[model samples]
Target: MSAILEVENLRVAYPSRQGPVEVVRGVSFALGRERLGIVGESGSGKSQTGRAILGLTAAGGRVTADRLHFDGIDLRGASPRIWRQLRGRRMSMVMQDPKFSLNPVMTIGRQIVEAGRRGGVSRRDAKARALEMLEAVQIRDPGRVFDAYPHELSGGMGQRAMIAMMLVGRPDLLIADEPTSALDVTVQLEVLGILDDLVRDRGMGLVFISHDLRLVSTFCDRVLVMYAGRVVEEIAAADLDRATHPYTRGLLNCLPRIDAEARPLPTLERDADWAR
Candidate 1:
């Protein structure tokens, strides 16, 4: 598959009282029409990398890259207008939680329709597309959900609605930041299955960012292990157990196995050099 997104030496910094602090330092990766998982501990800059790609960083944050391209478009130099045209149209994001991401006042269907409209679809057509997307995400009753507000839905339903809204535009690339982290194991698997099917059927690229090493290994094609704002290792998901990097091994070892003997869980030992 051809590359859908590319980044080289990407950096994101913020001005601090102590001077400039780099949250994402020299991160680089390429994504294709396949599921790519970014796994790391919290504050490791995994989310920042995704946000920088979408140009959604905070006002005080500065993002710079030697090369940042999306479908051959130079994202590093993209104007605000260009970004507006691209974001939610050619590319979209499914954030961690729907309660915070969704508009509490708007009906779920209306939000999905608005997203479709942003991609240049008419209101009438967008509404139809919204219902279709809701159903595509496996919502049993699309009509009922269409009229429901974000606050009226359960966690899983709200997440499915959020997915519907994001995918309504039929974006080429989807950045899902720990999208299933807030759900139960059963719901998490269900959501993962939905995402898997959509990516396969739509031929869209996915950037699945999460700290769940086991989940990512099974659900994604490749995995990028990050530490201290940098990619410490990149390995095929199938070969995750064979990862050589200490950070990756540490993460994998932290996962409790069902067959393991009863013993205290191993604690991850961090090396300061990994952050350098």
Candidate 2:
């Protein structure tokens, strides 16, 4: 079967006095109804690659690809109007920070309901569906959650609410950019479980972007190890223990282990060739 989303030779760049700062250089990948994790250190361009496909590049950043398709639709040269219509309804992104994503003045319920409304759901039915989604994300006291403002919720609650809102449209492809980064460890696992359930139940494709190599190895089905602005390795998540790329091996070596030995975890080694 063809991929639900596919990107080929994608490159994203920002103009700088030092010339163009290329953030994503010739990166490519495909996704099906499975969890695909993109992992790398800070400034590795993992997040930039995800946002480029979703038409959410930062200011002054330009996105280009030889071919970018979503659900069989060509997205390489799609206009902003077309992108706006495609985003949120056919595909959605869950940002890292809900505090910035959610409107400060709007009630949680209102924002979630509006998400459904944009997808052609009626006002009343959208509210009902919003409540149901909130429940699905393990948000207790749905009534209070619905009525409260964004500022009234805790970080975990807010993140769950954001997930609920993003999935309300039943988007075919979901790009989750460190969706659990702000939450506690326990909450992080809880949120991961929720996302797993969504993929299983709805057959949705997921692109999970994060710097947490250990977490990604455990949670994702496949992993893409990135360095600088390119993918250095692609391996099965379960096989991350035996990954071959120097960068991948370095990451694993740097992780703290339960059984072993060193007072301080060994630092990862990266060579200039790792960026090629």
Taken over the whole model, the C-alpha lDDT of each candidate is 0.90, 0.88
Specify the poorest-scoring 10-residue window by lDDT in model 1.
181-190
lDDT of 2 by residue, 1-276 (tens): 459998999999999999998989999888999999999888999888888988889888999899899988898888888887888787988988899999999999999998888756799999998999898877879999999999999987898899889988888899999988877787687778878987889888999998788888899999998899999999999999999987888888887778988767587866988777
**Tens digits of per-residue lDDT for model 1, 23-102:** 99999889988999999999999889999999999899999999999999999889989999998899999988898999
Q: What would the TM-score be for candidate 1 when compared with the true structure?
A: 0.94
| Candidate 2, residue 141: how far the Cα is off, in Å | 1.7
Q: Which ten residues in a row have the lowest lDDT in candidate 2?
A: 261-270
Q: Which candidate is the best by lDDT?
A: 1
Residue 2 lDDT, candidate 1, scale 0-100: 88
Q: Once model 1 is optimally superposed onto the true structure by TM-score, how far is the C-alpha of residue 200 displaced, in angstroms? A: 2.8
**RMSD after CA superposition, every candidate:** 1.6, 1.6
Clashing pairs in 1: none
